[model samples]
Target: MAIKDTSETVDNKLEDKELDKTDLASVTNGAILGRDLTPEEDRRILRKANLHLLPIMAFAYLFQFLDKTALSYTAILGLREDLHLKGEEYGWASAIYYFGYLVATYPIAGVLLVRFPIAKVIAITMFIWGAILMFTALCRNAKDLLTTRFFLGMAETAIAPGLSMIVAMWYKRSEQPLRQGAWFLGNTSAGILGGLVSYGFGHLHLLWGFDDSCFHHGSNLSPRHVRDDRFLTKDGRAQAVARVETNMTGIKNDKWKREQVMEALCDPNAWLLAVAYLASIIPNNGLLTGLGFSVLKTLLINILPSVFQLVFVLISVIGSTYLPNTRLLFMALNVVVSIVGAVMVREVDPVHKWTRVMGCALGVAFTANFPMTMAMVSSNFAGFTKKTTVSAMVFIAYCAGNIIGPHLFFPSEAPGYKSGFLAVMICLAISAVLCIVLRFYLILENKKRDDAGDAIEVPLEGINLSDKTDREIPQFRYIY
Candidate 1:
């Protein structure tokens, strides 16, 4: 009988040393996964790896945001009147999706994500959600729409946390921010593309002159339409594992550890990140999802804030790359900008419509905190189970924030939702304070660890060979 390592392998993969056959096997099988893969060869192969990996993530995230926010567009287009939604009913519709998201995220991460092939889980969920999105266009009433949307949120609950885990799996720590940025650019990309798509949906017609079906068809077709063929098979997979061994990125923590779970739960900084997420999502999701009800024109509503958001996301991601210890700094600056925008929204004259638009856009721009915070998650934690637990915890905060966010913009607060904007500013302020405290905690911990033999950065091979959690490693420095 084959050993479990070989017996359980889905692709029947062979190690690099085992592939020390002829030169033809190395050439035909893969580029990076061969034996004794060199650094220069690794760099060459990384380009190929990114090509295979990044676009798949970017596309999924792009459409996920687009589909998730499609209801906001539909709100302005006539979803409420058609469905006979009264008062805060639409807010409930918006908020309910996150409830399903909250319920499903942890179980899925613990069970499906931890126990199965990640790429397969991601792809299957994308397909499942795509099908759910199609059912959205067929809903006849609030109940039907809510049913489809709640399931949609449940399926999508896997992507963000799953993507974060995959990022750690594939890239080195330093490469993570930019790669995450590139995929996360899909957020702003969704803003720009989704806004334009939504605008087009409202104004234009397609397929025998029925325009509304476009959203239904578009959401379904877009995901299923583009198939990612990068997943390897047979010996190709063996070569990929060779490349992975070069990074030692696949060290397993398969056995359950009660202590790891306890450590994750007890950490104060974990609570701080969760609180920050809870507070931040309230305002950001409120502004992002329900902005249609404001005085802004539909075209501008779709486009302008996204323009600001796109620029800021790009800037912050790039800035984080060059500026050391600047994640908290950029987060603080975003909060300042958001607070100013809130003040602008409150104090500005009603007649100056664009000024108010600018204020809202500035407020929405604070979404850069998302990528920054997630980067914090990936860089700060280690070990499979612990990191998954942290991701589940933070996203629960995410679901709570989003669930509460919509309700803050009641029908009573129409046109100028003073209370809504004020609440967001307060949330941003709270998040900013949390960022500082988290940074300070990280700094203090690094100082305490410095006395041990943790000075120089150790190779991934060293770390992975031991399968040490960040908590277990004396030298594991938390990235700010």
Candidate 2:
């Protein structure tokens, strides 16, 4: 198909009748301007673009999750016994992984994602971390395992946030929740895959198997090789490029604006979201890895939660796609369920082991809000640097929570970590409240934007390729 001449197509529309910023709010949710996108044309470009984007993203993320969670799998597969891990050393090992991620993500995103193509950067990191995963096989002691895990964490740190920026680059704000759900599904997929892999370790030793390390070939998914722009005729390239330009997201804006960073820092919503994220992760991060090893201590039971979570993830994605503004609603609801699950896991009597196990499964279903939050980050934030900065901050919180999470479950707690459960319950309660607060705050902000008359006295012509901050752009509307 030929590239749709968005410039010419839009020129006539702009000249005939311009869309005011009031309509820009509609545009923020993926409305088309004039007749620039016929129904058929819109579907065609979107199908083509998503066809190009989703598969690689899912595959890369699958391995990223699998590689990270492989450490957890190793727990059931004899890692602790093999490494002679006593008490808090395993906790330290778990915590150190995110510690590496915490320190690495900021500089990597600031320097690398801003400068080079994100696909290249993702590829480089995937390979490096895969090598690190392979290196994990060589660790003979707890110290060696800790070192390897830390570097592996560092290698994988930028991936989720970087991919968030990439999805924003390609898809509109409205479609992001669905697309983000599609990619983030990889985490669930990894959980399932890790379960199966751990099962393999239980039955047939999977160590050093050629295919065991899916990371070796995960890097082969270079965008050039997959969604090759070269294969697209000149017209197609123009259409694709115009879509990005229209989206007001440039592929590369070399200069990092200080004001954008400052705006992100000043944005209270960013902090609220970050804190909510941190709270949500603490219950689920470190303890999640040990659930199977601790409770049932059986390989099949360990893998079962992932299966249930995969179902939950799919259900949440479909719910978001159909329901529109109910993302936060589902988030709060999921956390409430998770809190019930936490209590069950902590307090179930010996006769009700199965009930407790079911509760544990339900509690970890809090993955619902993550895709929503990532989509929120992309939809709400404008300006490349500001968005990136916010993305970085979110990951910083993610890293911190994951890092601190393991420590909450002390070795003293053994099979039932009461303190850990209580801590998670409190954080999750806080997160649930924050979810409502964030939703209300955005609703108020949107109402105020409507009152302000959503018209930019002077809007930019095509795209804000200059990377203007959302605060600088009065016409911009933040999406909930």
For candidate 1, report its TM-score.
0.81
Task: Name the TM-score of candidate 2.
Answer: 0.86
- The parts of candidate 2 lying over 4 Å away from their true place are 1-35, 202-221, 224-231, 243-251, 286-297, 454-456
Give the number of the best model, judged by TM-score: 2
Local lDDT at 98 for model 2: 85
In angstroms, give how far residue 296 of model 1 lies from its true place. Answer: 9.9
| Clashing residue pairs found in predicted model 2 | 3-235, 22-454
TM-score of each: 0.81, 0.86
Error of 2 at 31 (Å): 18
lDDT tens string, model 1, 293-356? 4423564476777788777787887898788778877877777788888888777866666677
lDDT of candidate model 2 versus the reference:
0.69
**Residue-by-residue lDDT tens digits, candidate 2, 135-158:** 788788988988988898899876
Query: Which candidate has the top score in lDDT?
Result: 2
